[model samples]
Target chain A: MIVAIASGKGGTGKTTIATALARIWDGPRVAVDMDVEAPNLHLFLAPSYDGRKRAVLDVPVVLHPEACSGCGACSRLCAFKAIIALGDYPVVFPEMCHGCGGCLEVCRRGVLGAGKRELGEIFWGRAGAADGASPDLRIAGGQLRIGEAMSVPLIRQVRTKANEMLAEHPGDVIIDAPPGTSCPALSAVREVDVLLLVAEPTPFGLHDLGLAVRALASGRVPTGVVVNRAGLGDDCIRAFCHKHDLPILAEIPFRRDIAEACAQGIPLDHMGELRTMMETLARSLRELAEPRVAA
Target chain B: MSLIAVSAQGDTPEASVDPRFGRAKGFGLYDPSAQYWSYLSNDAAQAQAQGAGLAAVELLARAKVTVVLSGSIGPKAAVALRAAGIASVEGADGQTVRQAVAAHLEMPQRGDAKS
Candidate 1:
């Protein structure tokens, strides 16, 4: 089963939950970090993989220095306004360019040419036995280059590579999605069969959680929630769940050790209760995947 | 010269009635006769559902070159136009639709036009 762990806000322990779950379920599993813009899962997994492999997500634009006749036809046809004329020459902003190649097709002079810009890198590694030995669990993630704004395409590339890895070793897949309910998060969520939403008990958390929940519901994916740092906040999250008919799968209390371990690049196993809770969460997740097992 | 349509959004030719907040709304340029931009829209609504923006295919169906005069566009729209053999232009401001079109037509051609 494909399981995606997501949160509305950043720093709510979505990666912690995803890594812990992967560690607990000792089987053929692939942990894919689709937070392309800021992939941090590798900090915990520490798989000794090769150096970065450049991944490019090309955006199309018109190179006016070539065949562009200043006909303005390409500009007139573009819906995104990606093209603009400065004096007599047209300049293409690589960041804003989507690589649509419309300029090449529309140019009466056939001036447009294809060009690519590097967006990010996809890394692969195996978790060390000392960290949390799971021969079956292989970790792969994508890290977007800083200052790059296009995240959905990079996330899509990560998912595609993860899918390719899974095909080779057929097993359960757990995806750590980026925070928020935007296109990047949506891209991660769409590929999963089950979704685990990690939410905090703050007002902001609740608000973002509602957005995430709405996005998941719109996609018709079965979803559950795990309230991280549960002991700090009131019962607003619980009440909201009750009213919305959403399930509260687990509640992780606030712990300094967990925070320290994360800061020190240590896994959740360093904390006793958090590890146990993650194990239980893993079992429940398996049950959710195979409901008939309960019967 | 083939006709292409452009929208205010950067590269997505898809027609959206309501350009989401922070997203630009405008026409997309493409070779209208080639039907290349149609590949951008996964469904009919995305391609032709005219709430606010124009689909890349729809833009291509109308014109050969598109001049984007808006703020931004999503990646899907950009990829669709590239695949359909469309040309894209960006950074168009302070100009009306007619002025943008006129500027594009006056630009120099890079190579011989394809048959």
Candidate 2:
């Protein structure tokens, strides 16, 4: 089963839930961190890997000044408006470019050419105890270059890797999605069988939780909520869930030990109750994935 | 000189406010008509197309809009617009389509609006 852990707001424990689940789940599970921009799961998992692979996104068409013939054909065919005609030359803005290749196709004089540019990198390897109770897990994630505006493409690439791993192993895969209801989050949610929305118990948390729930519903994915940092706010989250008939899978009480474990780069298992909660969550997820048994 | 088409609002106030074009004021050079600016529809559906890179260019060519007012534009579209002799103004915000056109027309020729 492909399970995606997502939240509308950042720092709501998405990676924490994903990593914790991976630590407890049996079998050859895969944990994929699709938050390509500022991927922090690596800091949590600390997977021992072979080597990292550079993931390249499509490069914009580059205009060649030496190719002669300043015909406006290239400009006329570029849909993105990435190319501009200036006097006898054309200017190409790389950042605005989506690398659609329209200019190359329309440039009769062959003034435009295709090139490759690096967008991000993917790190893959194994995590978990070498001889512990949990099965050895294959983990992979992508990290987009700082200040890179394009994230959907990199996230798509990371998801493709996750799909390949699942095809080979055919086990549960947990994806940690980036915050916000934008292109990157949408791309990450696509093709996932289920989504686990992690939110806190505050009013801000409830608001963002609604946003995430709406986003998931639009994506047509089965979604459940896990209330992290519970017992802090008045029962606004619980009240909202009760009114809306939204299922509350589990509520993790506010605990300093879990926070300290996270601060020290230690796994959630360091805290006994948190570890048990995550294990129970994993079991419920596995049950959801199983075919329904008739009464 | 390139024969360029700018939306009345993108070029001059009188042009953008003119009712002949359906009160449509924003204009940007699109390789085809798919990217043409239209105030009639809130959905920018006229601009969206599915295909490889070159089809986007064709859509711009068909639309023939010379410049547009947008919060953000991708580099590929910007490059295509420039090569087609289209001038793009950065930071165009809060101006009605007519006002934006008037502003573009009033600016001194900086050699950027060649098309």
Chain B TM, every candidate? 0.46, 0.46
Tens digit per residue, CA lDDT, model 2, A1-295? 7788898888888888887888888887788899988798877877888458887756545456777476777656655545655446666655546667777777777666776667778888877575242776888889997766788877877888877777876777888899988778888888777778888988789898888777764535556778888888878888877876666777878888767778887777557677788888887766654542111
The number of the candidate with the highest TM-score is 2
- Candidate 2 chain B worst ten-residue window by lDDT: B16-25
- Model 2 lDDT per residue over B1-115, tens place: 3222333334433343322121223443322223233432212323434222223333434454455444344455455555554455555445545455546556775643553
Clashes of each: 106, 49
Candidate 1 per-residue lDDT over residues A1-295, each given as its tens digit? 8889998888888998887887777678888899888788877777777445788966554544655566667666655555543324454556665556676677676556677878888887667667654567788888888888787777777777778877887888889999988888888888466789999999988898888888865535667889988877788789888988878888988777667777887667557777777777777777665642323
What does DockQ give for each predicted structure? 0.04, 0.14
User: Which residue runs does candidate 1 get wrong by more than 4 Å?
Assistant: A61-73, A84-91, A100-109, A290-295, B1-115
